[model samples]
Target: MQSTQLSPRYRGLRLTALAAVASMLAACGSGGDDNGNGGKPNTKPAYIGAVTISSYDGATDDLLTAGLGKDGLASSTAPLPLNPAAPTAAELRRYAIYTNYRAIVDTSAGGGYGSLYGPNVDAQGNITASEGKVAGVEYVAYSDDGSGQQNVTMLVQIPTTFNTTQPCLITATSSGSRGVYGAIGTGEWGLKRGCAVAYTDKGTGAAPHDLDTDTVALIDGTRTTRAAAGKNAHFAAPAGATSLAEFTAANPHRLAFKHAHSQRNPEKDWGKFTLQAVEFALWAINDRFGAVSANGTRQRTLDQDKVLVIASSVSNGGGAAVAAAEQDAGGLIDGVAVAEPNLNMPPNTGIVVRRGAAQVAASGLTLYDYTTTANLLQHCAGRATALTQAPFYTNPTMAPFFAARCQTLAEKGLVTGANTDQQSASALQALRAAGWEAESDDLHPSLAAFDVAAAISVTYANAYARASVTDRLCGYSFAATLTDLKPAAIAPAPLASMYATGNGIPPQAPVQLINDRDPQHGPYLNLPSVSASTQRADINYDGASCLRNLLTGSDAAALALQAGQGLTLRNGNLRGKPALIVHGRSDALLPVNHTSRPYLGLNRQQEGVTSKLSYVEVENAQHFDAFIGVVPGYSNRYVPLHVYLNRALDAVYDNLTAGRALPPSQVVRTTPRGGTFNTPAPALLPSNVPPFAATPAPGNAITVTANTVQVPD
Candidate 1:
C-alpha cells in the first residue's frame, strides 16, 4: 500500500462502473422520492447566503467558495511543544486550534444540496426510497492564515423513518485521503440504518484540481524562498510530466518528503479543515435545516445532542478524525472510530532503526534514508558484487550498464572487498550515473524494481556521508548519481499522499527524535541541530536542486513539528470517549502495530473508559481492498466489512446514548478468492499471525492520569 500503484486519475473507469451499479440499486430501493415524510414534500425556500452553491468540480468557478467567518479572525496562538512526551488536558486545550465556523449552505432553499442516493435497497435488493435520502451541501470555513475561505462539501443522509420518533441520530464521518467523495464511496448501507450521516471534502474540494497535491501547495505555500530552486521549486515537475503525482513518482526528489510536513499550523491544517467540515455539518443540521421544519416551525432533523462521529481512512484521515473530535473540547462528538491510520508521517522509523538504517544523513536525517536501505535490501542484497549478477546484469538493456559499473567497482576494490557502506555508495554512484544518463525517456514498468536498486545504493551513500562529515555538513553528495537518483522505469504516484496529522497531544511512545541517532546512522546528538549539507551539495549539484534543498532543512524546527504532529494520537489520548479501532491484519501500508496497541491501551487503562473502546482486526485484508473498489485477485476479491462497520457504529451509538458497554472485539475472518487474471494465487498466512482477533493487548493497558499520559520510553 505504501508503494506506488495506480493514480486516482486512473480510477475513472472503475469508479464510473461502480457508480452506475450503486445508482441503479439505489433507484430500485427508493420508492421514487414520493412516499417519504408525513406528507408529500414541497420545494424548499432559496438559500440566503453570500455565495451560491454549484455542482462539485475541480475548478473554482464550478464549485461553491463563499462564506463569512462567524467568529471573525482565526486563532494565532503558538502551537504546543513539538513532541511532548505527555501533554496535560489543559495543554491540549491551550493548543487546540479552530477555524471560524458556520453553516454556509441555505438548506431551506430548494432540494438541499441535491440528492446522491439511489432508491434505498433492502437485503433482498428491494427498493425502499421512503426509507432514507442522501443530500449533499457545500459550505466554507475561514482560513486561519487569513487566506480566502476554503469550500467544503458535505453529504447528509437521513433515514426517512427512525425507531424513535424524536429524530435520527446525527453521525458524521471523515476519511483520510479521498475527502467527502470517498466517505460516500464505501456504500451507504450504514447510512440507511436509521441515522443522519454527514461527510465533507476537506477544504481541498474548493477548486477543480487533485485534492492531494493542491493541498500540498496550500500548506507549503507558493512563494519560493530560494530562487535558485527554479519554477517548480516547491514541487518540481517530473521531467515533462505535468501531473503532480507523476512528477513525484518519476523523480522521487528529497523535497517530496517535505510535502508531508509542509501543512500549515493553526487554521490551514487539513485535519482542522476536515474536522470543521464535520462540525459545520452538525451545526447545519441543528441550526440551519432544523431551524425551519417541514411545516416551517423550528424542528430538528436529528437529535443534536446525540452526535457521534466516526472515521476510517487509508492513512492520516483516521487519526485526523480522532484529533478533531478530541480537540472539540466542547464534546461535540460522542464517540470515535478509526481504520488503519497513518499515525506517523515519516513512517516505519522503528523498523529502520532496528535495521540499522536510521542514519543521520549529512543532508539531515529522514525516514526516506531508512527506506533507501530497507526496501533495497528487501529486494537486492548489500553486496557490491550483486551488480554483476544475473537478474540485473544479464538483462540485455541493463547488461552493458551493469558491466561498466561492475568494472568501476572492481577498480575501486568495492565489489571484491568487505563492501562497506562507503564502498556501496561509491559503486552505486557509478552504476546510477550511467543508467540515468542513458537518454531514454521511454521508462519501463520494471522501473520500480530499479528504484529499489537506487534506494539501496543511496542508503549506503547516505551512511558514508553521515560518517565522513560533521552533523552540520550531512546531506546528499555532489555525485550525479546522488543528485539524480530516480529509477529508469516509471511508476504511478503512491496511492495516498502522506500527511502530518494528529489529535493535538503528545505521543504515547518515545519516537526516534531528529537527534536520536540509530546504530545505522551513527552517534546521537544531545542538542538541537541543523544540516548544512544542502548548501554544499547545491554548489556542485547536478540533480534536482528542489529536492536537494530539503536535505539542509530536513531537521528544521517547523519540519519536526509537522512530523511530530502526525503521530500525536498514537500515544493513547482518547479524551475518555468510547472508540473502536479496526485494522486489516495483512495491511502492508499501515501496520496494525502502528494503530492498535497504544489506542487500545489508553482506553483500557482508563477506569470507566475501558468498556468504551473496542479493537477489531480483519484477516487476509490489504488496505485498499477493504475500502474502495477491490483489486480483483491480488488479495480480496471483495471487501465485505460494511455490515461489520455498521455494527460498530451501532455499538458506538448504544454506548453513547444508552450507557451500554461496547461489544467485545473479534477477528473478522476472510476467505481468499484467487483465480482470474486479476487475482493472484491465494496463499495461507503464517500461523504466528492472529486471524482477526480483538482480545485486548496484553499487560496493563496505558492509562491517562490527570490528562497526562505515559508512553514507552
Candidate 2:
C-alpha cells in the first residue's frame, strides 16, 4: 500500500471528464430577489457575468490567449474583463488533475532524494510523464493566500470535444507536479491515450498549463476569474462520514487545489486545499450533469446514465468528504469510487491534526501517525477493546466502504492480525497497557513487525520471510534441476497459495524461472546516499495520495466505465460480472495478500448484478507496469488502453444520444508476465562475476510495482 497514488483512476477521470463543460453548467443562479413568496425562484440559474455563457468550451482563441498574456491581466470579452491568471471557464471545463512526474536529479554534488537509477534523473530528461504523442507543459503557480506560499505546477493537454455527453473524474495534487509526478508527465497511462490532462507541480518541472509557470507575475486579476474559497469555518462531519482533521486555510477551490503539492506538508500552515474542489464538483455535477438542484438541501437526481466519482487520494482527505457528500446527496453519483481513500485515518504517520473541512485531506499515515495496517489495527483493536464505542462519524470509520472488504482480505493471507505494520507499531505499547495483545493467537507479534502496507511502501526489493526464513517467492520455488534453464527462456511463475490458487477466475501461467528469494535492486540505483525513506518520496509514498479516492473491482470499475461512457454486458448466470483479477505475484508493497480479497469481494458484491467473476495471477509484474509492458486489457495497452480506446470512445458517443447502459456481462483476461520460462532456471553459484551483474534484471522488474505510488514524499 506504500500509499499507492491514484494514477489508473486518475486516467479514468480523463475519460469521465470529457463532459466537463456540459456537466458544470451553473444550474440556476439565485437573484436573491423576493419572489411571489419573499424568497423567489429566478428564471434560468442567474448568469455570473454581464454576458451570459452557455459553457466554457474555449469558444474563442482570444480567451485562451488572454489568460496567458497581458501582465497576468489578459482581459477578455465579457465575464468582468477576465484576468488570465485565474482558471478560465474553458480551462476549468477541460481540466484534468492527477499526480504525474518525470525523474529529476539534484545534481549539486550530493543532495536530496538521490537519482532514479545509476544515471541522474535529469540526464534521463526534464520530463518522463509517459511516451504518448500528446504535448504537455509544466509549471509552478504561486498563490498569494497571503500565506507566503509559492506553488509550482505542471499542465498537460486535456483535450475535450464540444458537447460530448460524458462523465469526468478529478484528482488533487497527489504528486508534487509534472502532472501528478515530476520532470514531465511521461509515467502516465492516460497521456498515451491522448486524454486532455492538467496537474500541479509534483516536482521541479516546467509548467505547461499554468498561466504563470515561469515568472513571479501571475495572470493579472487571476483572483477575479477564480471562485473565492469558502471561509475557514469549522464544520462537523456528516452522519456516516468520519471527521479526520481540521485546519485554518480556506478550502482549495479547483484552481487552488491545482497547487496543493506546491508547499511541503507536515505543517497545518502547509494545509492541503482540494476539499473545496470536491464539494464544488458535487454541487456542480448534481446541478447540471445530472438533474439535481444546487442547494445543499435539495434531493439528488442523476440522468439515467451512471456518473462516477474518482480521486487521487494522495491529497484526498477533503475530496473524500466531498465524494461522500455527493454520494449521500442521493442521485448525483450512481457509483462512488476512489483509488485508495483514507478519509479519516491517522495519516502523516504521527502528525496530530485538527479537523478542517477547508483543508485538503492527505491520503495516508505519516511519520507522525501510524502506517496503513497500524491505523487499521488501531481501528480493529479499538472495536475489540472498547466497552463504549464511538459513532461512525465520531469513532469515524475511515474508508468504511472499501475497508468492509476486510473480511475478503482475511480469507486470503493479505491481512493478518499480528504482522500488520500498524499492529506491530503498537505491539509493545498494547502489551504493556492491556495485559495482552488482541490477536486470537498473539505470537507476541512484534509491534514493528513487517506489515504488508509498510513493507511494500519502503521498497519492492524485499524478501518476504517469517524471521530466519532464508528464501521466499510469491508461491513458487526454484526447481532443484533446471531442465529449461536457459538465460533467454527465464520467466516468472504464478503464485500458488492455497486460497489464491483455488479461487475461481482466469487461470494464470506458472513462473518459468522460480527463484530462491525476492528481487533486490535498491543498491543497483548506485546511490548509497539514498535510503528507503528518500526512495519513498521520489517513487514510493502512496499512503496519503491514493487514500483520497478508490473503489474496488467490478462495481467500482463499472461505475468508472459508466462515468467514462464505456460498455458492459450482463452475463447469463445473473451473478456479478466475474473479473479476472490480476496483480504482481511477487509484489512487495501492496503484497498480493491485501489485494486478493477486496478483488474477490468486488465480484461477490456485484453478484446478481453481473456474471462470472474470475481472477488471474501475473507472475513477476509490479503495480503500474502491467499496462506499460504487457498484460493487455487489465494492465495491457491492448485490452483497455489502446485496443479498447476507439471502442470506449464509440460507447461515449452512443451514450450521448441514446440512454443505453453498458453491457453488464463481460469477460476479462490479464496478461502473463513478460517472460515465459519453458521450465525453470539453473541455480547460479555466487560466480566470479560482479554481484551487481544479476541486479539490473531485478530493477527492470521493479517498474510493474511502481504503478500506483503516491506523490513525491
Candidate 3:
C-alpha cells in the first residue's frame, strides 16, 4: 500500500492555499476594496438547487459510520429512529448510512469485516483498534433542471484530513436503485485516502411516491405531500392524461417508485448524472478551498489539471462510473475502478467472448433480456438436481412451487421434459444457454427464493417502457400485501422510513410485487398468486413471460422499451483513461459473460491499442457480499467480492498517483472459507481471497485479440 502522508512540497502548497483563503475571508469581512476586478462572489452551478451543508465531529455524528463508528456498524441490528411514525432528517440520514453500508459489505467478523476491509481498516490495510470515524463536512443538493422532474441527488463528503495540495475525488454513484447513500461502502475507500467522495443516485432513488397517500420523499429523505413539496419533490407521479385522484382511486394501495414510474427512462441519463455529481463535488470543494480573486470571486484552486479524479462504485453505480468514463468528453475523469458493473452492451458489436476454446452460448445481452429470462426459468431451475446443495433448495414449502413452475414451463413448450425432474434439468440448461455459467448454479435457488430476478425484471421493464405506475406493466404492481396475500395499504411507519430502507426495486420489505392479472385471486402477491393462463401457482409465470416478450415483441410498448434500452447501451470508449474492472465469475444476477467479459471486448474494439482497461475475474466470489454472512452455505462456498473491489481501487489509485503498473487482466482463483452448511464459516484470511497479480500465471491470463475476449477455463 502507498503511504497516505503528504510530501514536503505538497504540505507547503497546502499551507499557502490555506493562508490565501484566510486572507481573502478576512478582506471580505473587513469590506476591503477589490484586489483587481469587480467584487463578485463565486456562483453555484446552474443545475444545482438549494444546497444543504452539515458538519460532523467524528464522535457523536460522523460521515462514514454516521456516529455508530466501526463497532456499531459491525452490529447485527441497526439503530432505529426514536419515533417510528416519523423519523427526523438526521435519523433518516444515519439510518441510510448504516443500511447502505451493510447492504454492500459483509459485516460479520468471519466474513473479514474488521480484518480485510471495514471502517477500522486503514487505506494502508493496517488493522487498527480505533473506531474509524471521519470528521467531515457534507454538501448535498439536487442536480436538476427547472422542472425538478429529474432531481438527481448529489452529495459530497470532504473529510477534514483531505489534502488540499494533492487533491483527489472519487465518484460513488448509487448501486442498484438505492438512494444517495447506496454506495457509501465504496466511498469509504476514498474517504480513508483523504479524497473527496462524490455520490449521485443517478436519477433513481428509494423515494417512492405513495400514490394513495399523495405523499413523496424530498432530497433529504423527509416525506411531504406532493402539493406541499411542489418543485422540491424528489419524485411525483405525473398527471399524464388522468388526474392523480382518479389514478389512485382506480389503483388504490399501489406505489410508484422513481425507477419504475418516473417515465424519464432514467438509465439513459445515469452517466450524465454521475458526471454532474463530479461537477458538483468540484464546485463544493472550490467553494470551500479556492482563493478569492481580485474581483472577490473564488478562483479555481482545484481542477482536472490539479486534482486526480477516479470514477468508482459497484453494481449499477459501477455501471454508471463506466458510463461516465465513456461520456467524459470534458476529461473530468482520470481513471476507473469498479466491481460487478451492470453493463448493457451495444447491439451488433461483433465482440465474441470465449472461455478456453468454446465460445460463450450467449453474450452481450442487456439487463432486461437476461433478467427477464431468469425470472421466467430460475424457479424451475432451482429444482434441478445439479442445484440440490444450493441454499433454500430443500425448503419443503417452496418445493411445490418449484415443481409447479417446471410443470408449467414444460406444458408451455418452454422446456421439453416428461416429468418435473426432467423439466427442471431443461430449465437449468436454458439458463446456461442464455449466458449463465456453471458457477452460478448454486446461486439460483437462493436468488429465486428472494425474488431477485422478478424484482429486477419488473423494474427494468417498466423503466425501459417508460410506463406509468397505473399501467402496472406486465400486470405487476408494487404494494403492501395482507395476510391473504392481497393488496393492502402500506403502514405509515414503513412508508415514513422507506427512503432509508427501501431498495428502490419492489418486493422489498413491506412492499410486495402484486399480480394484478390473477383472476382466481384478485391482486395477490406474485409468489402465491395463480397465473391466469396456467391456473397454477407458478410464481406468476404469465407476468414473467410477458416481461420476457418485451425484448422480442413488436408492439408499440415493446418498441418503446427497445428504444429506451438502446439509449442506455454503452459505446465502451473510455477516452484512454486507465481503468480496472473486477467481477465475480459466480455472479448469478449480472452474469460475467453478459457484463464484464463482453464489456472488455467492446472497450477494446472501440479504443483499440489506446485502451487501458484491465479485467479481473474472481472465482468463487459472487455478487451481494451481504449474502456471504447472512445466507446459509454462502459463507462456506463464496468469498466476499468486496475485498477484490477494494484491491482494485487501491491498484487504480497507485497507478494514478505513483505511476505504478496496473495489474494485468487475469482470473484470480479465490478459495472459499469452507465449513459445515448453515454454520458460520471460519474467519476469512488473506489466503482465502488472493490479490490479482500484475503478471498472472499462464493459465489464469485473460487475453484480448482482434476484439475477442478469451478467459481461462
Candidate 4:
C-alpha cells in the first residue's frame, strides 16, 4: 500500500546531503583517526574492467534455472572472463558510500581501531592489516537512491594492463539496500588467479543512519534556517511530547502520556522514506562474476546463476514485501536467505517456528521506549533513576507506567488489558499471570508489544490520561496494531503478509552468534540469549554510536566475524561474504538442518555468476554457549576483517564472484569456554567441494577455485 505519510526529515535529509558535498563531514571514530591512510594501496598492475548483463530476458532465464537448484550452478564456472565496466561517477555516487569507519566508545579513538590500539582488545593478535580493514569502526554514511534494486547484477572489471584472462577470481559485497547473494567465498591465501573485491552497512546505527550527507545539514540546517526551505523542514514534535525518544530516555520522566497537540495535527510519522531508497554494496567475481571463457565472458543477474542468499534476519525482518513484490519483480529473486523469517502465513502458524509479541508500543519496544516508560513517572512522582534501583527489567516503581500502557490499549480494543478477562479471575491477575513484572521487555517486538500494550492500556484508563476512545488506531508514536498470536490462525495474504514487524530476531539466531559458555546464564555459549540476539540493536542502531556498539549491537556477529567461525552452507556451492556467522541447530533462530536459498535464486539469474556469499554457521551450536558472550583467553576464531580481507579477496576473485574454488578458512579451537558465552568448536566446512586450486586473480581482486569433486545430484 502506498503511504501518504511522510517524514519531513526525508526531504530535509536529501537536501542536506547534497549541500554537504561542499561542507566538511563531521569527524568521528577514535578522535577521527585511521581513514585508510595507513594501509598502502595495492598498486600491483592487474586486469580491471567491468562487464555487466545490462539486462536479461526473464522468461528465457528464470524459467530455465528456477528448477535447476544448486547442482547446476556449482559446475558452470569452468570457464570465465575478466572486464571492469566503468560505471560513471554520477552513477556510482548514487550508492550509499561507506565514507569512513570510526570508533565510538571507552577510552577514546574509535572502536574501529581498538583491536590495534585500545582497551577493546588485549592481544591484538596477528589478524593481519588486510583482514582488519575497519573493525570496531563506525561507518560514515552517504545514501544513493538510484541503484535499481529490482534487478540483480554482476559487474566485473579487469585491469587494463593484464589482457590475457584465464581462470580469474573475484569477490564482492552486497549492498543491504538490495539483497545479498554469493557472499564472499573461501579458498584464498593464493587461489583463483583473477580475483576482485567489493564491500556495505559499513556504518553502525538504526536503518543506516545519516544515510545521506544531506541529513546532517538537513537537520542542522533546519535548526538554523528553516525559513530558506520555506518550512519544508518545519516538522512538528509529537504533539504533547516533552522530549525526543533520545531526550526522554536520557532524562527521567513518567512513561505514560496522552497524545496532545500532534505536530502534524492528525498525520503520523511513517518512518524513514525507505520505500523510496535502499542501499547496498558488494564485489562479485569468479563464476559469481561473469564467467570467463575462451570466447570472452558474459555477465547475468545474480539470479541467473547458482547462488545462495545470506538471510537479512536483521534487515529484511522477514521480507514480507519481498514475497508480495516477487511476481511484480519477475526475475529479481531466486532462492531466499531469510534468517529468522516471520513466515506469517496461517500455513506457517501452527508449527510455532518461533513466537514473540506483536504490535509493541514505543514505550516498550526500544531502549528509548522502556527507558522512557521507566522515567515517565520518576520525576512526576519525584524519583530519580528509579528503575536503576532494581533489575531494570523488574523494577517495581515503574508499575504505574506499565499499567498506563495496558489500560490505554485495552479500551481501544487493541489488546486485552487490566480489564481483560470475562473469565480468568480479574484482568489485573491475568496480566500478572501473563508474567507482568513491572520492568520492560521492550527488547523485541515479541515481548515489547505485550509489555507496551499493558502499559498503554493502564495509562489510558487512568483518571487523568489525556486520551479518547475515538483516537485513530493508526497513530505512529508506536506499534499499536499487531498480529494476534493466540490460538487464532494467522490470516493469509494481508494479515500474514502485512508489512510490519515488532520486536527482535525470532530467538535462537541471536544466541547462535553469542554462543555462551555458562549454565549460570547456564547453558551459555552455543545457545541464543535475550540480550545478544536483539534485532533492534542489530539492524537499527540509531540509538547510539560506539565502536563497542558494532560488537554488541544487533547484527553484532555479522559486523564482528572472526575467521573459521561463521555460518556456512552444508553444500560446497555456496559463498559467504560480509559474512554473518551463525551456529547450526539453532532451534530458537533459523530452521534446523536446512540451507536457505536467497542467493541460489540470484545465482540462477546470473547463470551461475556471483562472486560472494554472506552467511556462515557452525553445526548444532544452538543456545548452548558455542557462539558469543564473555568467554575469554581463547582468540575469537571469528575472522577479523584484517585476517579475512586477504584470504576473502583471494577467494572472491577465484571462487566467489568468479565461480572457482579457493582454500577454505581454517577452523581452529578459537572460541572461549567460560565467563559468559563460549565459541562454537571448529566451524563446519563443506565436504563436497570440487577439486580446487589456489589460483591467483588478475591484479588485486580476490580469487578461489575449489578442489574438483562431483556435486550431488
Candidate 5:
C-alpha cells in the first residue's frame, strides 16, 4: 500500500514540468449552503481561484492530442467569483473540507516503489518506460474546520508521446494515500501508449496511527469511544426471535465472544471523499488542458471525454469505486474496472452478517459478525492463531477448548511437527497474555504455532476430519492435485492444510448450532426469527439501529448508507456503461459472490443492457491477489491476476469507444505457472456448487436484452 506517487519513469517528462507562476489570491467567501438539509451554511465556504501553471517549458507537445493545440490551454471557466452563490467549485470543494490552494513544482529523484518492477508496462502489456513524465503539483486546500490547510496534493504523469490521431485517455488513480502511489506507478505503464495519469489525495488516506481518528472526523465529525464498547448492548430478546443468549442457552458449548474492531463511523462520508478525489482529477484535466492549450505547447488537447476512473481494492476502497460510479451515474464515470471490490453494503444485509435484533441485543460483537470460518481460514498458521486469541476469539468456552484441543493434537502427533506441545503451548500462552497485556504487541509471530495447534485441534474437533491423519497444513490445497494432494504444476505450493480443512464452521463452534447462519460471513444474514431455508430472508436492520444508539446525535443517514439504502456520493449502480468486474473465487476479505450478487441485482433492476457488464471469477484467486501482487516473496499458486485484469480493462475501453461486444461473463481459468491466456477461461467449479447454488443461479454470461443470467459450466 504505497502512497500514490508518480514513478521515476517520468524522469524524461520532467523537463517540461510546469514552472511556478505568480498566483492570484481570490477573496475567501462561503461558497454556498451545501448541507442539503436546506439549513444555513455552518462554516465559511471554500474559495477556488483560476488554476495557474507556474512553469511550462513546452519542450515537446507530442503528448498533447492534436484536436486542440497545446498553446493557450486554460480553464474554460474563469476563477470562481468570490460571491457565496458561486457553487460549482465551492460545491465540489465542500465534499472535501479544504480551504487553500498553492501553486508549486515538486520534482522527485524519479525513484521509489516503482523501481522494484522490471520496467514500466504499457496498457498493451508491453514492457517499456520511454514516454512517461511524473511531476508533483502542490495542491493546497485549507479546511474550513479551522484546522488550517491540508495539502490535497496530486501527482500528474503524462506520456511524452500520444496517439494524437485520436483523443488521448486520462486515467485518474484515486486509490487513497497509501495506494495512490502504487496505482500511479501501475497506471504509468499506460503512458507508453499515450495515456495521461493523475493521482489525487482524497484527504482520507491518513497514516495508520491517524486513520481511525481522521476517518471519524472526516465522516462522523469526531471520534468517540463507546462507553458500552465491551458491554453487551443488545436489547431484550424479541418474541419469536432467536437471541444470542437463547442460542447459547440451547448450546452451552458455544464460545463467548469479546467484541472488537468496534470503531465505526456513524457518518458515511468516505464515499463522498472518494468521489471528491475523482472530481479533483476531472478539474485537473481541465486545468492542465487549459494550461497546455494556453501555452501553445501542442496543437491539440487531452481527451476529457475519454477519461476513465480505474480502482482496484480488496477492502473498503474496493467498494468506493463502485460507490463513486453509482453515485455519479456515468456523469463523471464512463466505465469502471473493479477486482474483488468490497462494495459498501450495510451490515446485517447478507447471509454472512445478519443477526436477529434480539441476538444482536445480547452481544457487543456487532462488528465481529464479519468474522466467519471462510474469512478466518484465510489467516493461516501464525495468522490463524489470531482468530482464537482475545479480541477476535474471546469466546470464553471455545477459546479454552480450542487451546486444549491444540495441546491434545500436539500430543497425538496429529499436528504439524514444526513445534512440540510444550513449545506450542508456550507460544499460545504468550499470545493469550499479549492479548490481555498490550494492544500493540505484534501477535503475528506467535500465530504460526498457534495456527498449527488450532488447525490440528479444529480438524480433530470437526466430525468431517475424524478419519484423517495429516501432514503440515497447506494453503494451496484448493489448487492441489486431487490424486496426490501436491501442488499441481505450480512451484512451491504453499501447504494447503487450510484449504483441506474445508470452509465449514467447525463442530463445537457456536456457528454450527445456528440453523439460519451462512458459514460464509458477509452482509447477508438470515434473521434468527426465520428458518435458514426460508425465502423471507432480511438484513439485520437492528445493526444500524444499534450503531445509531451507540453514537448519540449521529445522523440516521450514516446507518442507512451502511445498511445499503441511504443516498451517498456513490450509488453502486452502473449507468449502462461498459464495465468489467473480476473477483477471486477464494477472496477472504470479500467473497467472489459479492461481485456476482451486484451484477444480478443490477440486471434485475436495469431490465436490459446486460452486455454492459462483464463479471469473471478467477479460479483459486484471493481477494487482493487479483490486483495487488502476491504477498512479498511468497510463491503464488495463481497467475499474476492483474495481467488478466489489465486485459479486461483493455476490453472495457474497446467496448466503450469502439462499440465492440463485451465478453460474456465467465470463469477465468488459471494455467500452470508461465502459462499465457489467449482467451477468457472457465471455472474450475460449476455454479451449481455450494456457494453459487446457495443463491439464485446467474447463468454463464448475462443476457443483454432479457437481462437474464447464464452460468455456463
Candidate 6:
C-alpha cells in the first residue's frame, strides 16, 4: 500500500495557493459566511440540485452493506419492506443496496463469496469474520437542469476511515440501467480501501412513471404524483402530441422508464453524469472536512490536484468510466479500472482486432447494432442442434417459440435452411459472423430464454431514438401482465417498490414487455404475443426486426436512432491516464469483440505509445456473476468475473498511488469450477482464477502494434 501523505514540497505549494484564494475571498467580503450570506457561494456545481445528506453508524445503518452485512447480503432472500404498498425511503435504500449488490455478485459461499471477494474478504484478500460495515455520511442529489427532465441521480459516500490526507475517490456509475445503488458491489472495493466512492445513475435508473396513475418516483425511491413531486420527480412522462389523460386512456396500464422514455438520449451524457458525480463528491468532501476559519467559513481541504481519483465500475458503468476518462478535460481522473465495459467505438477507426490466427469478421459495432441483431436471431439460434446441450436449452415452454422463430427467419430469407435445425444453425452462424465469438455460443440459449436480448433491444431502441412512451416504438410498451398474458394494471406494491427491484428494462416481474401490435391477443406479453403478419407466437419477431431495421434502415426513425448512437461513441482517448480493462471472453451481453478488444485497438490507434491502457481477456468467465449460484449450469462452467474486477481495481490503485507498473495486456485462461450441471460446483479456489502475471507468457500476451490488436488462442 502507498503512503497517504503528500510530499512536503507539493503540500507547501498547495497551502500557498489556498492562502492566496482565502485572502482574495476575504477582500471580496465572501470569506466568512457559513449561512450563505457570502463565503464563495457554496461552490456546488450549478448542475447539481438540492442535496440530501444522511449519516450512518457502521453497526446498524451503514454505507457499504446497507446494514445487511456480509451474511445478509449473501442470503438468498432479501429483506422486504413491512408495507409493500408504500416503502419508506430508508427501506427502499436498503432493498436497493441488497438487490443491486446481489444482482452483480455471486453470493453463494461455494462460488467464492466468503473466500475470494465479499464484504468479509478484506482488501488484502484475507478472509475475516467481520460483517464489513463502514460508518459513513451519504450525500444524494439530482444532476439536472431546471426542467428536472434529466434528474440523473448523484451520490457520494465518504467513509469514516477515508484518508483525508491522501484522499482517494472512486466513481461507481450505476450498471445496467439500475438505480443509484446499482454498482454497490463494485463500490465495496473503494469503501473497504478507505476511499470515498462516488456514484451516478448516468441519467438512467429504475425510476418508472406509472402513466395510468400519473405517479412518479423521487430521488429517494419514494413515489408521488407527478404534479405533487414537481421538479423532484425522478421521471414523468412529458406532454406528448396527445394529452397525458388521453394517452393513458388509450394505452392503459403502461409504464414509462426513465432510461427509455426520458427523451434525453441519456447515454450521450453518461460520461458527463459520471464527471458530475465526481464533482459532487469533491464538493461534499470539502463541505464536510474543509478547514473552518475563525469566522466559520469552510475552506477547501481537498481538490483535484490533491485527490487520487479513479474512474471505475462494471458493464455500462464501466463504459461511463472510460468515457469520463476520455472527456476529462480538467484532469480530474488519475486512473481507470473497469470490467466488461459496454464501449461504443467510433465507426471507421481502421483498427483491426485479431484473435489467434484468424482476423475477426466484424469489430467496433454499436450496442444497438449487435443487441438488435441478437434480439432477432438469438431465439432462432437457440434452436440449433449444436446448442441443444447448452445451458437452459431444455425449456419446454419456450422451445416451441424457438422453433417458430426459426421458421419465421427461414420464411423471411434471413436464414437459409430446408429444416428448423439448419435454419437455426444458419442464424447462429450469422451471429458469429457479426462479431460474437464462438465462446459466446453456449450462453445464447440461457440469455435468449431469459429474454435478455429482447429486453435490451427494446429499451435501447427507445432510448437512442428518444421516443416517447406514447410512440410505443417497435410496437413495444412496458406494462403489467395478467396470468392470461394480457396487459393489466401494474400492482401498487410492484410499482412502489420498482425503484428497488426493477431494472430499467422491462420484463422485470410484473412489468412485462407488451407487444401492442399483437393482432390476435391485443396488447399482451411479448413472449407469447402473435405477430400479425405470421400469426405465430414467434416472440414478437416483427418488433425485433423493426429494431434491427433501425440499425440498417434509412427511414426517419432509423436515422434518428443512428444519430443518437453517434452521440454515444467514445473517442478512444484516455487522456494518458493509466487504465486497465478486464473483460470475460464469454460475455454474451456485451461481447469483447465489439467492446474491450476493439476499444483497446482504437485506444492504441488514438494515443499511440502515449496510451497506457491494458486489456485482460479472461476465459471461462461470462457477464452476470449473479447467475452463477442460481442458474444451474453457470455454477459449473463460469468463475465469478467480479473477482477479476476487484483484482483490476487493486492493480490500478497500486499503480496510481505507489507508482507501480500495470500488468501487461494479456489473456488470463481461467479454469471453471467444473461439476454436475444442477449441483453447486466445488468451492472456488484461488487457483481457478489466478492473479495477473507481472510478465505474461508469450502465448497469453495480448499485443497491440499500430492500430491492430492481436490475441493468442
RMSD of each: 18.3, 22.7, 3.4, 22.0, 20.0, 3.7
- Each model's TM-score? 0.46, 0.30, 0.95, 0.29, 0.45, 0.95
Ranking by lDDT: 3, 6, 1, 5, 2, 4
Q: Whole-model Cα lDDT per candidate?
A: 0.32, 0.23, 0.88, 0.21, 0.31, 0.87
For candidate 1, lDDT tens digit of each residue in 1-713?
01112222222323334323322223111111122244322222121112222222212111111111111112123333343423332232122111101010111101111121112334233445332232333332222322222323344443333222222333333343223334442224333454445554443221111212332222222122222333222222121113445533433321221112112222124455555555544444343333232443333332234344454333345666655655666555556665655443223222210001221112112333323322222121222343332122224543333333333344434343333334434534432322211111111112222432232222222222222111212223111111123212111121111111121111100111121121223222111111232212111111112223333345553244334334342334556566766665554334443345334544444433434566675654444432222222333232333334444555555555455566455455555433443433333222222233224343212223332222221
lDDT of 4 by residue, 335-404 (tens): 2222222221111111111112221111012111222232222211111123222112333443343344
Residue 3, model 6: lDDT of 27
Q: What would the per-residue lDDT of candidate 6 be over residues 649-672, giving only the tens digit for each residue?
A: 998888765567889999998998
Q: Which stretches of candidate 6 lie over 4 Å from their true place?
A: 1-42
Query: Can you give the lDDT of residue 33 in candidate 6?
Result: 21
lDDT of 5: 0.31
Q: Which of candidates 1 and 5 reaches a greater TM-score?
A: 1
Candidate 3 Cα errors over 4 Å, as ranges? 1-42
lDDT of 3 at 404: 93
Q: Write the per-residue lDDT of candidate 3 for residues 488-550, one digit (tens) a residue.
A: 899999899999998999888999999999989888999877898989998889999999899
Evaluated at residue 252, the lDDT of candidate 5 is 28
Model 2: per-residue Cα lDDT at residue 350: 27
The regions of model 4 sitting more than 4 angstroms off are 1-131, 134-338, 346-713
Total backbone collisions, model 2: 142
